[model samples]
Target: MKIAIVGTRGIPNHYGGFEQFADFLSQGLVQKGHDITVYSSKNHPYKESDYNGVKILHKYDPEDKIGTAGQFIYDLLCMADARKRGFDIIYLLGYTSSSVWQRILIKKSIVVTNMDGLEWMRSKYSKQVQRFLKYAEKLATKYSDHLVADSIGIQSYLKKTYNAESFYIPYGSHVFSEPNKEDLIAYGVTAYNYDILIARFEPENNIEMILEAFSKSSTSRKLLLIGNFKHTDFGIRMARLYGEDTRICFLGPIYNQVALNNLRYFSNLYYHGHSVGGTNPSLLEAMGSSSLICYHNNDFNRTIVGNDGFPFDNYNGLKEIIEGKRKEDFFHFLTENIEKIKNIYSWQRIVDRYEDYFLSIIPKS
Candidate 1:
């Protein structure tokens, strides 16, 4: 099958969730004997090379910032190209301008879009952007042949809000092996005696609350917060507030897989403060790393970790976890369910599910 993937900043996945998902799925599908071509931004720094067996087609965009106008222009170009190229399936990751245009341009294309999260609910966007997203989302669901929800939470949202039936396929984790002594030394950590929280510093992520809770705790364990500090004002403030603290280490963004895996694997516990969105990549990675999970949102976290892990909405509740009162339950949950999570959320399993879904969409000869 000839498949075209639309709606990402392009790959090697240095960015966020959708890029990573596209990279993994395209590579895995290509390996499984499908002809896969991913539509990437021409600005992405990769040569026009075959990743594994998949082809990378770089589409040029006029605008620099990836806001509404820029994405609209990008999608218009992609839609025009996709209509001419004639692929078996066109998979859209986000409900951006590109996705909306693709649906209009390539009516015959078997469109499958993954509604990543409730974008309208996110705190980052303005009222106008949120209204635009709501419209874009409606168009995406109405026109697409299939909708892929990354979590049950998202699946429920789609069904309840849009009355859209979606395929529930969660994101996979890239688990890393234990880091060496040299790797630890490179990060300036004497030992891996710390808790880790890796997320983009945003208002919805509740980074400030987590920092305050961790700072107030008398625990010997340190808190390592990793993310891009230059992306937003929230990140900048977080860097200024926690960067100098001895107990809290703001490691900025570490893109290296080996270093990231080392930090994840060696952590005593993994903290997820994201109150919005479906299943998070960082949380899945932590589960795959066998790290004890502590999360901010009860509804979504409980879906993943059950009652074994700790779920805290406030700083005080988070402090209780740091004080060691909830350590045993979190650890017990990790030990008991880590294997199950590994089996279910592994990339191989996830890719297989995707393959089945893709094959189901293909028409019979």
Candidate 2:
């Protein structure tokens, strides 16, 4: 099988979820004796032509140069190349940019899109941008040959809204066990000593609410926030809001997987405040590391975490969990989460499923 993965920064996953999925899925498919090509942004730090046996194609991404408008140009350029290449399948990771070119995508290849989270419903986008995103969702649905829902919640939305049938394939994780203790030294916290939270510092992610709860709590455990704190106004304000508190440590973006896994592996508690997203990669990572998760209560999150993890809505809810008594069932929650990753959410299983799906839908030529 030959596959072209479009609409992402590309392999080695320097970006977020989709990038990570592309890196893992492409490499996994290659190992299974499939030909794989991944489109990467020109600005990606990994300047190599190949990554882990998969071919890499660089597309001009002017996000740094022209901001959000550059993504539209980049997706167009990628799809144009994809249409010409004639791969067995063109897998699109998201629809925000690619849906604009839906007419050209028809009959090019078996185009499958992962209908990620409720993008149009996010509060961060202006009403106008949200309307356009909704249109993009419709356009993407109209053109794609198949759809994948990362969570059951997403699957339900696709059905209820568009009456579309989508394959359910949640994100996977690697069970990280061995971590070098030295990785946590520079961060000035011991293993299982600090509470950790990682998010984009956006409104939809509920970073403000998490920070508010953490601030109000009088816990001895330190709070470690991992993200590009200087990227947005909310982040800057959050930093300054809690800057004076010595207990809150604003550790900037740590992309290194080993170091990140160490943080999750050693965390006494992990907070996932993202109110929007489908089977978030970070949550999977926490589960893979067997870190106890405190996720925001939502259908998307609940489906992934099940009853094995904690859930909360507002600061008051989270504050009580943070400062209040640790449930006797918490240990059982940890065990179940570990079992969930091993059995249901392993990356190998996910990769195999993706291959099966692609093969099942490939035109009988």
Candidate 3:
């Protein structure tokens, strides 16, 4: 089947979770012999003529900024071109006003959108942007032929908010091989010497709270925070505040897969402070690496890790966990849960689920 994936910054996944999801699924689907096309931002320099058996179409819009508005414009252009390309299905990763327009323009196309976390609920957006997103989300749910939610929590939200039923397909992760001793020396750290947190340094991620709590803790483990320094004003401020600390190392975004995997694999523990978003990629990656998990939201983290890891709602809770004030059977639980995660969240399994869903939607000839 010919398929077109829309509503992402594009492939190779140097950015966020949705982009990574798009990259992995598109490649996986291509391997399954489906004709796939990924609409990418023209501004992204990695636009190759072709990528791993999938076609890449670069949409150029210079007026676009890196926000919701920019994405809407890019999606408009992509939808117009995709309609002309006559794809059997248009798989959208997120919602936008342009998606509403796409539904109007392409009546026969099968629309499938993955409503990735509650974006408008995040504190990072301005009030006006949030209002726009809420409306767009309504249009997306009302119009799309199929919807996918990345986590059970997100699926529940969709049903509660829009009374819409969606397929639940969690993200995937792969365990990292141990890095070479020489490579570990380059980072000036021995294996398992530090705790790691990888996320966009936004307020919703609760980065400040994590930093404050970790800094006050008595744990001897060093803390390494990796994320894009320029993603937000909060990121810049936090980098300046935490970068100077001896125990805390603020390494700007490390995009190399080998380096990131090694860092995660070798970490003593993984800290995830995102109070929003469904099934975060970093958390899954850390789990795949068999790192001990301590995260922010009780409901969100527990949904993924069960009782295998620690959950904290505030700075005090985080500190207590770090200082060993709250000790449970986390390690044993973690070991057992790893098997569950390995079985459920493999990329091949996730892509197969997607393929099954897509085929179920296609009309009989």
Q: Give the distance in Å from residue 302's predicted Cα in candidate 3 to where it truly belongs.
A: 1.6
How many Å off is the CA of 336 in candidate 1? 3.5
lDDT of 1 by residue, 224-279 (tens): 88898678998988878876778788778988877777776667778888877777
Candidate 1 clashing pairs, residues 3+ apart or interchain = 75-98
- Runs with alpha carbons beyond 4 Å of true place in candidate 3: 63-68, 179-181, 325-331
For candidate 1, what is the total of clashing residue pairs?
Answer: 1
All models, RMSD in angstroms? 2.1, 1.4, 2.3
- By summed lDDT, which 10 consecutive residues of candidate 1 come out lowest? 325-334
Residue-wise C-alpha lDDT for candidate 2, range 247-273, written one tens digit per residue: 899998998888989888778789998
lDDT of 3 by residue, 1-365 (tens): 99999888788786788789888999999999999999888987686969999899999754455554576677889888888877899988888545567565447688888888778888877899889888888888888888889889989989998999999998887755565545556577777777889988789888899899888888877888888767789988987887777888887788877777777767777888887768888888888776778888655667988777778889888888877732233567556556756688878888998899889889979
Clash list (residue pairs), candidate 3? none
Give the local distance difference test score of model 2: 0.88
Query: What TM-score does each of the candidates earn?
Result: 0.93, 0.97, 0.93
Q: How well does candidate 2 match the true structure, expressed as C-alpha RMSD?
A: 1.4
Best by lDDT: 2
